[model samples]
Target: MIKIDDYAYTSGLKDVHPVEKVSFALIFLLFTIISKNIWVACFTFTVMSIGVLFKAKIPFIAYLKLLFVPFVFLMTSLVAILFSIAPIYQEDLEVLWMAEIGLWQIYISSYSIQQSYELATTILASVSCLYFLVLSTPLNQFIWVFKKVKLPAVFVELMGITYRFIFVLLEKMNEIYIAQSSRLGYQNYRSWFSSVAQLIVSLFVKSMSSAKELQIAIDSRGGDEHLYDVDLSMGYNRGHFVIIFFSFITLFMIYIMTKS
Candidate 1:
Protein backbone atom coordinates (compact mmCIF):
# COMPACT_ATOMS: atom_id res chain seq x y z
CA MET A 1 0.00 0.00 0.00
CA ILE A 2 1.07 3.58 -0.55
CA LYS A 3 2.39 5.42 2.46
CA ILE A 4 -0.60 7.74 2.58
CA ASP A 5 -3.04 4.83 2.45
CA ASP A 6 -1.15 2.95 5.13
CA TYR A 7 -1.08 6.01 7.34
CA ALA A 8 -4.79 6.57 6.83
CA TYR A 9 -5.67 3.01 7.81
CA THR A 10 -3.45 3.20 10.85
CA SER A 11 -4.28 6.77 11.84
CA GLY A 12 -5.33 7.50 15.38
CA LEU A 13 -8.41 9.23 14.00
CA LYS A 14 -9.22 6.37 11.58
CA ASP A 15 -12.13 5.27 13.74
CA VAL A 16 -13.70 8.72 13.59
CA HIS A 17 -16.69 9.00 11.29
CA PRO A 18 -15.62 9.70 7.72
CA VAL A 19 -18.21 12.47 7.37
CA GLU A 20 -16.65 14.36 10.24
CA LYS A 21 -13.21 14.18 8.66
CA VAL A 22 -14.51 15.13 5.25
CA SER A 23 -16.49 18.07 6.55
CA PHE A 24 -13.58 19.30 8.62
CA ALA A 25 -11.13 19.15 5.72
CA LEU A 26 -13.43 20.70 3.12
CA ILE A 27 -14.67 23.43 5.44
CA PHE A 28 -11.16 24.48 6.36
CA LEU A 29 -10.12 24.28 2.72
CA LEU A 30 -12.89 26.74 1.80
CA PHE A 31 -11.92 29.03 4.65
CA THR A 32 -8.29 29.03 3.62
CA ILE A 33 -9.12 29.69 -0.01
CA ILE A 34 -11.50 32.56 0.69
CA SER A 35 -9.37 34.13 3.39
CA LYS A 36 -7.78 37.46 2.42
CA ASN A 37 -5.52 37.99 5.42
CA ILE A 38 -2.21 36.20 5.78
CA TRP A 39 -2.89 35.59 9.46
CA VAL A 40 -6.04 33.65 8.67
CA ALA A 41 -4.15 31.49 6.19
CA CYS A 42 -1.40 30.91 8.71
CA PHE A 43 -3.92 29.99 11.37
CA THR A 44 -5.58 27.47 9.08
CA PHE A 45 -2.21 25.99 8.24
CA THR A 46 -1.28 25.62 11.89
CA VAL A 47 -4.59 24.06 12.85
CA MET A 48 -4.49 21.55 10.02
CA SER A 49 -0.87 20.67 10.63
CA ILE A 50 -1.67 19.96 14.28
CA GLY A 51 -4.57 17.73 13.26
CA VAL A 52 -2.41 15.76 10.82
CA LEU A 53 0.62 15.38 13.04
CA PHE A 54 -0.78 15.14 16.55
CA LYS A 55 -4.43 14.10 16.23
CA ALA A 56 -3.95 11.78 13.29
CA LYS A 57 -0.55 10.61 14.60
CA ILE A 58 1.21 10.98 11.26
CA PRO A 59 5.00 11.16 11.47
CA PHE A 60 6.38 14.67 11.17
CA ILE A 61 9.02 13.68 8.62
CA ALA A 62 6.57 11.81 6.44
CA TYR A 63 4.14 14.72 6.52
CA LEU A 64 6.93 17.11 5.65
CA LYS A 65 7.94 14.94 2.70
CA LEU A 66 4.34 14.88 1.45
CA LEU A 67 4.11 18.64 1.99
CA PHE A 68 7.41 19.26 0.19
CA VAL A 69 6.04 17.83 -3.05
CA PRO A 70 3.50 20.67 -3.31
CA PHE A 71 5.88 23.23 -1.85
CA VAL A 72 8.16 22.72 -4.88
CA PHE A 73 5.30 23.55 -7.26
CA LEU A 74 4.20 26.49 -5.12
CA MET A 75 7.71 27.93 -5.24
CA THR A 76 7.88 27.55 -9.01
CA SER A 77 4.68 29.55 -9.45
CA LEU A 78 5.62 32.10 -6.81
CA VAL A 79 8.94 32.79 -8.55
CA ALA A 80 7.09 34.36 -11.48
CA ILE A 81 4.99 36.48 -9.13
CA LEU A 82 7.98 37.44 -6.97
CA PHE A 83 10.01 38.92 -9.78
CA SER A 84 9.21 41.30 -12.64
CA ILE A 85 10.95 41.85 -15.97
CA ALA A 86 10.98 45.02 -18.03
CA PRO A 87 12.86 46.55 -20.92
CA ILE A 88 13.60 49.70 -18.93
CA TYR A 89 13.34 50.58 -15.24
CA GLN A 90 10.66 52.98 -14.04
CA GLU A 91 11.23 55.28 -11.04
CA ASP A 92 7.74 54.63 -9.51
CA LEU A 93 8.10 50.82 -9.72
CA GLU A 94 9.58 50.54 -6.19
CA VAL A 95 12.19 48.02 -7.17
CA LEU A 96 13.86 46.42 -4.13
CA TRP A 97 16.63 44.79 -6.14
CA MET A 98 17.44 44.62 -9.82
CA ALA A 99 19.69 42.73 -12.22
CA GLU A 100 20.41 43.85 -15.78
CA ILE A 101 20.46 41.27 -18.59
CA GLY A 102 21.08 42.58 -22.10
CA LEU A 103 18.47 45.36 -22.60
CA TRP A 104 16.06 43.82 -20.02
CA GLN A 105 15.95 44.19 -16.27
CA ILE A 106 14.58 41.74 -13.69
CA TYR A 107 13.62 43.05 -10.27
CA ILE A 108 11.81 42.41 -7.00
CA SER A 109 9.54 44.86 -5.21
CA SER A 110 7.75 45.01 -1.84
CA TYR A 111 4.40 44.65 -3.55
CA SER A 112 5.51 41.50 -5.39
CA ILE A 113 6.92 40.04 -2.19
CA GLN A 114 3.69 40.59 -0.32
CA GLN A 115 1.66 39.07 -3.14
CA SER A 116 3.86 36.01 -3.28
CA TYR A 117 3.65 35.51 0.47
CA GLU A 118 -0.14 35.65 0.44
CA LEU A 119 -0.41 33.20 -2.47
CA ALA A 120 2.05 30.76 -0.94
CA THR A 121 0.40 30.79 2.48
CA THR A 122 -3.07 30.34 1.01
CA ILE A 123 -2.03 27.41 -1.17
CA LEU A 124 -0.09 25.75 1.62
CA ALA A 125 -2.93 26.15 4.09
CA SER A 126 -5.37 24.59 1.61
CA VAL A 127 -3.05 21.67 1.01
CA SER A 128 -2.58 21.09 4.71
CA CYS A 129 -6.32 20.88 5.22
CA LEU A 130 -6.53 18.18 2.55
CA TYR A 131 -3.60 16.34 4.09
CA PHE A 132 -5.41 16.15 7.42
CA LEU A 133 -8.37 14.36 5.85
CA VAL A 134 -6.44 12.05 3.54
CA LEU A 135 -3.98 11.10 6.27
CA SER A 136 -6.75 10.20 8.68
CA THR A 137 -9.45 8.68 6.47
CA PRO A 138 -9.13 5.60 4.27
CA LEU A 139 -10.37 5.42 0.65
CA ASN A 140 -13.14 2.94 1.45
CA GLN A 141 -14.43 5.29 4.14
CA PHE A 142 -14.55 8.08 1.59
CA ILE A 143 -16.43 5.82 -0.78
CA TRP A 144 -18.85 4.98 2.02
CA VAL A 145 -19.38 8.68 2.68
CA PHE A 146 -20.02 9.30 -0.99
CA LYS A 147 -22.66 6.61 -1.05
CA LYS A 148 -24.28 8.10 2.02
CA VAL A 149 -24.48 11.50 0.30
CA LYS A 150 -26.43 9.84 -2.52
CA LEU A 151 -23.77 10.43 -5.14
CA PRO A 152 -24.30 8.55 -8.37
CA ALA A 153 -23.32 4.89 -8.08
CA VAL A 154 -21.38 4.99 -11.34
CA PHE A 155 -19.29 7.93 -10.20
CA VAL A 156 -18.56 6.26 -6.87
CA GLU A 157 -17.75 2.96 -8.56
CA LEU A 158 -15.41 4.62 -11.02
CA MET A 159 -13.63 6.48 -8.24
CA GLY A 160 -13.11 3.27 -6.27
CA ILE A 161 -11.91 1.38 -9.36
CA THR A 162 -9.59 4.18 -10.45
CA TYR A 163 -8.08 4.39 -6.97
CA ARG A 164 -7.48 0.62 -6.97
CA PHE A 165 -5.98 0.78 -10.47
CA ILE A 166 -3.42 3.35 -9.35
CA PHE A 167 -2.02 0.96 -6.75
CA VAL A 168 -2.17 -1.96 -9.16
CA LEU A 169 -0.17 -0.05 -11.77
CA LEU A 170 2.34 1.04 -9.16
CA GLU A 171 2.80 -2.55 -7.99
CA LYS A 172 3.29 -3.77 -11.54
CA MET A 173 5.72 -0.95 -12.32
CA ASN A 174 7.78 -1.72 -9.22
CA GLU A 175 8.00 -5.40 -10.12
CA ILE A 176 9.06 -4.58 -13.67
CA TYR A 177 11.72 -2.16 -12.44
CA ILE A 178 13.10 -4.72 -9.99
CA ALA A 179 13.28 -7.41 -12.68
CA GLN A 180 15.00 -5.03 -15.09
CA SER A 181 17.43 -3.90 -12.42
CA SER A 182 18.30 -7.53 -11.66
CA ARG A 183 19.12 -7.99 -15.35
CA LEU A 184 21.44 -4.91 -15.33
CA GLY A 185 18.95 -3.04 -17.49
CA TYR A 186 20.12 0.30 -16.08
CA GLN A 187 23.86 -0.29 -16.12
CA ASN A 188 24.33 2.81 -18.31
CA TYR A 189 22.40 5.88 -19.45
CA ARG A 190 21.42 4.45 -22.81
CA SER A 191 20.29 1.18 -21.28
CA TRP A 192 18.47 3.12 -18.53
CA PHE A 193 16.34 4.92 -21.13
CA SER A 194 15.74 1.68 -23.05
CA SER A 195 14.78 -0.13 -19.85
CA VAL A 196 12.34 2.62 -18.90
CA ALA A 197 10.69 2.38 -22.33
CA GLN A 198 10.41 -1.38 -22.04
CA LEU A 199 9.06 -1.07 -18.50
CA ILE A 200 6.35 1.29 -19.66
CA VAL A 201 5.30 -1.09 -22.45
CA SER A 202 5.35 -4.05 -20.10
CA LEU A 203 3.36 -2.20 -17.42
CA PHE A 204 0.67 -1.26 -19.90
CA VAL A 205 0.31 -4.88 -21.09
CA LYS A 206 0.25 -6.23 -17.55
CA SER A 207 -2.26 -3.65 -16.40
CA MET A 208 -4.59 -4.60 -19.24
CA SER A 209 -4.30 -8.24 -18.27
CA SER A 210 -4.99 -7.40 -14.63
CA ALA A 211 -8.07 -5.44 -15.62
CA LYS A 212 -9.39 -8.42 -17.61
CA GLU A 213 -8.80 -10.72 -14.68
CA LEU A 214 -10.54 -8.31 -12.35
CA GLN A 215 -13.51 -8.19 -14.70
CA ILE A 216 -13.73 -11.98 -14.74
CA ALA A 217 -13.56 -12.05 -10.96
CA ILE A 218 -16.33 -9.45 -10.81
CA ASP A 219 -18.47 -11.44 -13.23
CA SER A 220 -17.98 -14.62 -11.26
CA ARG A 221 -19.45 -12.84 -8.25
CA GLY A 222 -22.50 -11.68 -10.23
CA GLY A 223 -21.51 -8.30 -11.73
CA ASP A 224 -20.36 -4.72 -11.04
CA GLU A 225 -23.85 -3.66 -9.89
CA HIS A 226 -23.39 -4.38 -6.24
CA LEU A 227 -19.62 -4.60 -6.19
CA TYR A 228 -19.06 -1.88 -3.60
CA ASP A 229 -21.87 -2.85 -1.23
CA VAL A 230 -19.65 -3.67 1.70
CA ASP A 231 -20.84 -2.25 5.01
CA LEU A 232 -18.59 0.60 6.13
CA SER A 233 -20.94 2.07 8.64
CA MET A 234 -19.33 3.49 11.73
CA GLY A 235 -21.96 5.41 13.65
CA TYR A 236 -21.44 9.14 13.86
CA ASN A 237 -20.00 10.85 16.90
CA ARG A 238 -21.79 14.11 17.68
CA GLY A 239 -18.90 15.31 19.83
CA HIS A 240 -16.56 15.48 16.84
CA PHE A 241 -19.16 17.32 14.80
CA VAL A 242 -19.71 19.76 17.65
CA ILE A 243 -16.00 20.42 17.90
CA ILE A 244 -15.79 21.06 14.15
CA PHE A 245 -18.73 23.45 14.28
CA PHE A 246 -17.13 25.42 17.08
CA SER A 247 -13.82 25.42 15.24
CA PHE A 248 -15.47 26.93 12.18
CA ILE A 249 -17.04 29.61 14.31
CA THR A 250 -13.69 30.36 15.86
CA LEU A 251 -12.02 30.58 12.46
CA PHE A 252 -14.79 32.81 11.16
CA MET A 253 -14.32 35.09 14.14
CA ILE A 254 -10.58 35.15 13.50
CA TYR A 255 -11.15 36.07 9.88
CA ILE A 256 -13.42 38.92 10.83
CA MET A 257 -11.04 40.20 13.50
CA THR A 258 -8.15 40.08 11.05
CA LYS A 259 -10.13 41.81 8.36
CA SER A 260 -10.51 44.88 10.50
Candidate 2:
Protein backbone atom coordinates (compact mmCIF):
# COMPACT_ATOMS: atom_id res chain seq x y z
CA MET A 1 0.00 0.00 0.00
CA ILE A 2 2.81 2.41 0.85
CA LYS A 3 4.55 1.51 -2.40
CA ILE A 4 1.33 2.30 -4.29
CA ASP A 5 1.25 5.77 -2.77
CA ASP A 6 4.97 6.18 -3.38
CA TYR A 7 4.52 5.39 -7.08
CA ALA A 8 1.65 7.85 -7.33
CA TYR A 9 3.82 10.63 -5.96
CA THR A 10 6.81 9.84 -8.18
CA SER A 11 4.93 8.76 -11.32
CA GLY A 12 6.19 10.14 -14.61
CA LEU A 13 2.61 11.09 -15.50
CA LYS A 14 2.10 12.90 -12.18
CA ASP A 15 2.58 16.22 -13.94
CA VAL A 16 -0.42 15.59 -16.17
CA HIS A 17 -3.83 16.98 -15.23
CA PRO A 18 -5.54 14.71 -12.73
CA VAL A 19 -8.90 15.23 -14.41
CA GLU A 20 -7.56 13.95 -17.71
CA LYS A 21 -6.18 10.84 -16.02
CA VAL A 22 -9.43 10.40 -14.15
CA SER A 23 -11.46 10.78 -17.30
CA PHE A 24 -9.32 8.31 -19.18
CA ALA A 25 -9.36 5.69 -16.45
CA LEU A 26 -13.12 5.99 -15.79
CA ILE A 27 -14.19 6.08 -19.42
CA PHE A 28 -12.16 3.02 -20.36
CA LEU A 29 -13.26 1.20 -17.24
CA LEU A 30 -16.91 1.68 -18.11
CA PHE A 31 -16.34 0.58 -21.68
CA THR A 32 -14.46 -2.48 -20.55
CA ILE A 33 -17.45 -3.67 -18.54
CA ILE A 34 -20.19 -2.54 -20.90
CA SER A 35 -18.64 -4.05 -23.98
CA LYS A 36 -18.64 -7.47 -22.34
CA ASN A 37 -16.16 -8.68 -24.93
CA ILE A 38 -13.08 -10.73 -24.20
CA TRP A 39 -11.16 -8.66 -26.75
CA VAL A 40 -12.10 -5.47 -24.97
CA ALA A 41 -11.00 -6.97 -21.66
CA CYS A 42 -7.68 -7.90 -23.18
CA PHE A 43 -7.34 -4.46 -24.75
CA THR A 44 -8.14 -2.62 -21.53
CA PHE A 45 -5.73 -4.79 -19.50
CA THR A 46 -2.92 -4.31 -22.03
CA VAL A 47 -3.40 -0.54 -22.20
CA MET A 48 -3.47 -0.05 -18.44
CA SER A 49 -0.51 -2.43 -17.92
CA ILE A 50 1.54 -0.49 -20.47
CA GLY A 51 0.67 2.82 -18.84
CA VAL A 52 1.62 1.52 -15.39
CA LEU A 53 4.86 -0.19 -16.40
CA PHE A 54 6.22 2.10 -19.14
CA LYS A 55 4.47 5.43 -18.61
CA ALA A 56 4.34 5.36 -14.81
CA LYS A 57 7.74 3.62 -14.50
CA ILE A 58 6.67 1.04 -11.92
CA PRO A 59 9.14 -1.85 -11.82
CA PHE A 60 8.11 -4.96 -13.74
CA ILE A 61 8.68 -7.36 -10.80
CA ALA A 62 6.73 -5.14 -8.43
CA TYR A 63 3.84 -4.89 -10.86
CA LEU A 64 3.80 -8.67 -11.30
CA LYS A 65 3.67 -9.12 -7.51
CA LEU A 66 0.71 -6.75 -7.33
CA LEU A 67 -1.11 -8.63 -10.08
CA PHE A 68 -0.18 -12.05 -8.66
CA VAL A 69 -2.50 -11.51 -5.67
CA PRO A 70 -5.68 -11.04 -7.70
CA PHE A 71 -4.63 -13.61 -10.26
CA VAL A 72 -4.37 -16.27 -7.56
CA PHE A 73 -7.85 -15.51 -6.26
CA LEU A 74 -9.24 -15.53 -9.78
CA MET A 75 -7.80 -18.95 -10.45
CA THR A 76 -9.05 -20.28 -7.14
CA SER A 77 -12.59 -19.12 -7.87
CA LEU A 78 -12.45 -20.50 -11.39
CA VAL A 79 -11.39 -23.88 -10.09
CA ALA A 80 -14.24 -23.89 -7.59
CA ILE A 81 -16.72 -23.11 -10.36
CA LEU A 82 -15.47 -26.03 -12.43
CA PHE A 83 -17.08 -28.60 -10.14
CA SER A 84 -20.40 -29.36 -8.42
CA ILE A 85 -22.00 -32.22 -6.54
CA ALA A 86 -25.37 -33.90 -7.20
CA PRO A 87 -27.19 -36.76 -5.56
CA ILE A 88 -26.62 -38.90 -8.64
CA TYR A 89 -25.57 -38.66 -12.26
CA GLN A 90 -27.88 -39.78 -15.05
CA GLU A 91 -26.36 -41.94 -17.76
CA ASP A 92 -27.95 -39.66 -20.39
CA LEU A 93 -26.73 -36.42 -18.83
CA GLU A 94 -25.00 -33.95 -21.18
CA VAL A 95 -22.28 -32.75 -18.82
CA LEU A 96 -18.66 -32.57 -20.01
CA TRP A 97 -17.66 -35.17 -17.43
CA MET A 98 -18.64 -36.64 -14.08
CA ALA A 99 -17.09 -38.53 -11.16
CA GLU A 100 -18.70 -40.66 -8.49
CA ILE A 101 -18.28 -40.19 -4.70
CA GLY A 102 -20.25 -42.95 -3.01
CA LEU A 103 -23.91 -42.23 -3.90
CA TRP A 104 -23.12 -38.65 -5.10
CA GLN A 105 -21.69 -37.31 -8.33
CA ILE A 106 -19.42 -34.34 -8.94
CA TYR A 107 -19.37 -32.68 -12.33
CA ILE A 108 -19.02 -29.41 -14.22
CA SER A 109 -21.08 -28.06 -17.10
CA SER A 110 -19.42 -26.28 -20.00
CA TYR A 111 -21.48 -23.17 -19.24
CA SER A 112 -19.89 -22.80 -15.80
CA ILE A 113 -16.38 -22.79 -17.20
CA GLN A 114 -17.33 -20.24 -19.87
CA GLN A 115 -19.01 -17.95 -17.35
CA SER A 116 -16.05 -18.14 -14.98
CA TYR A 117 -13.60 -17.15 -17.70
CA GLU A 118 -15.75 -14.19 -18.73
CA LEU A 119 -16.24 -12.99 -15.16
CA ALA A 120 -12.56 -13.38 -14.27
CA THR A 121 -11.35 -11.36 -17.26
CA THR A 122 -13.92 -8.66 -16.66
CA ILE A 123 -12.84 -8.32 -13.04
CA LEU A 124 -9.17 -8.25 -14.00
CA ALA A 125 -9.75 -5.53 -16.61
CA SER A 126 -11.77 -3.34 -14.25
CA VAL A 127 -9.19 -3.73 -11.48
CA SER A 128 -6.41 -2.75 -13.86
CA CYS A 129 -8.23 0.50 -14.69
CA LEU A 130 -8.45 1.37 -10.99
CA TYR A 131 -4.78 0.45 -10.52
CA PHE A 132 -3.87 2.94 -13.26
CA LEU A 133 -5.83 5.75 -11.63
CA VAL A 134 -4.39 5.31 -8.13
CA LEU A 135 -0.84 4.66 -9.36
CA SER A 136 -0.74 7.85 -11.44
CA THR A 137 -2.72 10.19 -9.18
CA PRO A 138 -2.14 10.51 -5.44
CA LEU A 139 -4.97 10.99 -2.95
CA ASN A 140 -4.17 14.68 -2.62
CA GLN A 141 -4.60 15.28 -6.34
CA PHE A 142 -7.72 13.09 -6.41
CA ILE A 143 -9.28 15.13 -3.63
CA TRP A 144 -8.09 18.33 -5.30
CA VAL A 145 -10.01 17.37 -8.43
CA PHE A 146 -13.13 16.73 -6.37
CA LYS A 147 -12.70 20.08 -4.64
CA LYS A 148 -12.40 21.79 -8.02
CA VAL A 149 -15.80 20.39 -8.88
CA LYS A 150 -17.17 21.94 -5.69
CA LEU A 151 -17.90 18.66 -3.92
CA PRO A 152 -19.15 19.11 -0.35
CA ALA A 153 -16.41 20.29 1.98
CA VAL A 154 -17.26 17.66 4.60
CA PHE A 155 -17.02 14.80 2.12
CA VAL A 156 -13.65 15.96 0.81
CA GLU A 157 -12.36 16.45 4.33
CA LEU A 158 -13.27 12.89 5.34
CA MET A 159 -11.59 11.47 2.27
CA GLY A 160 -8.38 13.36 2.92
CA ILE A 161 -8.31 12.37 6.57
CA THR A 162 -9.05 8.71 5.82
CA TYR A 163 -6.26 8.49 3.23
CA ARG A 164 -3.68 10.19 5.45
CA PHE A 165 -4.63 8.07 8.45
CA ILE A 166 -4.13 4.89 6.42
CA PHE A 167 -0.46 5.71 6.11
CA VAL A 168 -0.30 6.64 9.76
CA LEU A 169 -1.77 3.28 10.73
CA LEU A 170 0.67 1.46 8.47
CA GLU A 171 3.63 3.30 10.00
CA LYS A 172 2.47 2.49 13.50
CA MET A 173 1.92 -1.17 12.63
CA ASN A 174 5.40 -1.43 11.11
CA GLU A 175 7.05 0.03 14.19
CA ILE A 176 5.26 -2.43 16.47
CA TYR A 177 6.13 -5.40 14.25
CA ILE A 178 9.82 -4.51 14.17
CA ALA A 179 9.94 -4.07 17.93
CA GLN A 180 8.23 -7.43 18.46
CA SER A 181 10.56 -9.18 16.02
CA SER A 182 13.58 -7.84 17.88
CA ARG A 183 12.21 -9.30 21.12
CA LEU A 184 11.73 -12.80 19.63
CA GLY A 185 8.00 -12.23 19.72
CA TYR A 186 7.43 -14.39 16.57
CA GLN A 187 9.92 -17.17 17.27
CA ASN A 188 7.04 -19.66 17.61
CA TYR A 189 3.40 -19.90 16.52
CA ARG A 190 2.04 -19.37 20.04
CA SER A 191 4.27 -16.39 20.69
CA TRP A 192 3.54 -14.94 17.23
CA PHE A 193 -0.21 -15.02 17.80
CA SER A 194 0.18 -13.40 21.20
CA SER A 195 2.45 -10.74 19.79
CA VAL A 196 -0.02 -9.99 16.97
CA ALA A 197 -2.90 -9.64 19.45
CA GLN A 198 -0.84 -7.29 21.59
CA LEU A 199 0.17 -5.37 18.52
CA ILE A 200 -3.48 -4.73 17.64
CA VAL A 201 -4.39 -3.61 21.14
CA SER A 202 -1.29 -1.43 21.37
CA LEU A 203 -2.05 0.13 17.97
CA PHE A 204 -5.60 0.97 18.99
CA VAL A 205 -4.44 2.64 22.21
CA LYS A 206 -1.73 4.55 20.36
CA SER A 207 -4.14 5.66 17.67
CA MET A 208 -6.62 6.92 20.25
CA SER A 209 -3.85 8.77 22.08
CA SER A 210 -2.65 10.35 18.87
CA ALA A 211 -6.16 11.38 17.95
CA LYS A 212 -6.67 12.99 21.33
CA GLU A 213 -3.40 14.88 21.00
CA LEU A 214 -4.39 16.02 17.53
CA GLN A 215 -7.78 17.13 18.79
CA ILE A 216 -6.19 19.17 21.55
CA ALA A 217 -3.71 20.67 19.10
CA ILE A 218 -6.49 21.59 16.71
CA ASP A 219 -8.63 23.02 19.47
CA SER A 220 -5.71 25.13 20.56
CA ARG A 221 -5.45 26.55 17.04
CA GLY A 222 -9.22 27.38 17.06
CA GLY A 223 -10.08 24.27 15.04
CA ASP A 224 -10.15 23.95 11.26
CA GLU A 225 -13.28 23.01 9.28
CA HIS A 226 -11.91 23.91 5.88
CA LEU A 227 -8.48 22.43 6.35
CA TYR A 228 -8.60 20.40 3.14
CA ASP A 229 -8.24 23.49 0.98
CA VAL A 230 -5.11 22.94 -1.09
CA ASP A 231 -3.81 24.90 -4.04
CA LEU A 232 -3.02 22.88 -7.20
CA SER A 233 -2.43 24.24 -10.69
CA MET A 234 -3.94 21.81 -13.21
CA GLY A 235 -4.99 22.79 -16.71
CA TYR A 236 -7.08 20.70 -19.05
CA ASN A 237 -4.97 19.25 -21.84
CA ARG A 238 -7.05 19.03 -25.01
CA GLY A 239 -4.46 16.80 -26.68
CA HIS A 240 -4.59 14.08 -24.03
CA PHE A 241 -8.36 14.27 -23.88
CA VAL A 242 -8.61 13.92 -27.64
CA ILE A 243 -6.32 10.92 -27.68
CA ILE A 244 -8.30 9.15 -24.98
CA PHE A 245 -11.64 9.93 -26.60
CA PHE A 246 -10.59 8.57 -29.98
CA SER A 247 -8.88 5.57 -28.50
CA PHE A 248 -12.06 4.45 -26.74
CA ILE A 249 -14.11 5.22 -29.84
CA THR A 250 -11.90 2.98 -31.93
CA LEU A 251 -11.96 0.33 -29.26
CA PHE A 252 -15.77 0.39 -29.20
CA MET A 253 -15.95 0.14 -32.96
CA ILE A 254 -13.75 -2.94 -32.88
CA TYR A 255 -15.94 -4.41 -30.17
CA ILE A 256 -19.03 -3.90 -32.29
CA MET A 257 -17.51 -5.70 -35.27
CA THR A 258 -16.06 -8.53 -33.24
CA LYS A 259 -19.20 -8.96 -31.20
CA SER A 260 -21.39 -9.40 -34.28
Candidate number with greatest lDDT: 1
TM-scores for all candidates: the values are: 0.93, 0.91
In TM-score terms, candidate 2 sits at 0.91
How far off is residue 194 in model 1, in Å?
Answer: 0.8
Give per-residue lDDT, candidate 1, residue 132. 91
lDDT of 1 by residue, 128-188 (tens): 9989988999888888888989999989988888889999999889988999999999999
- Candidate 2 off by > 4 Å: 90-94, 221-224
Q: Number of clashing residue pairs in every model? A: 0, 0
Worst ten in a row by lDDT for model 1:
224-233
Superposed model 1: Cα runs more than 4 Å off:
89-91, 218-224
Q: Each model's C-alpha lDDT?
A: 0.89, 0.86
- Residue-level error in angstroms, candidate 2, position 247: 2.0
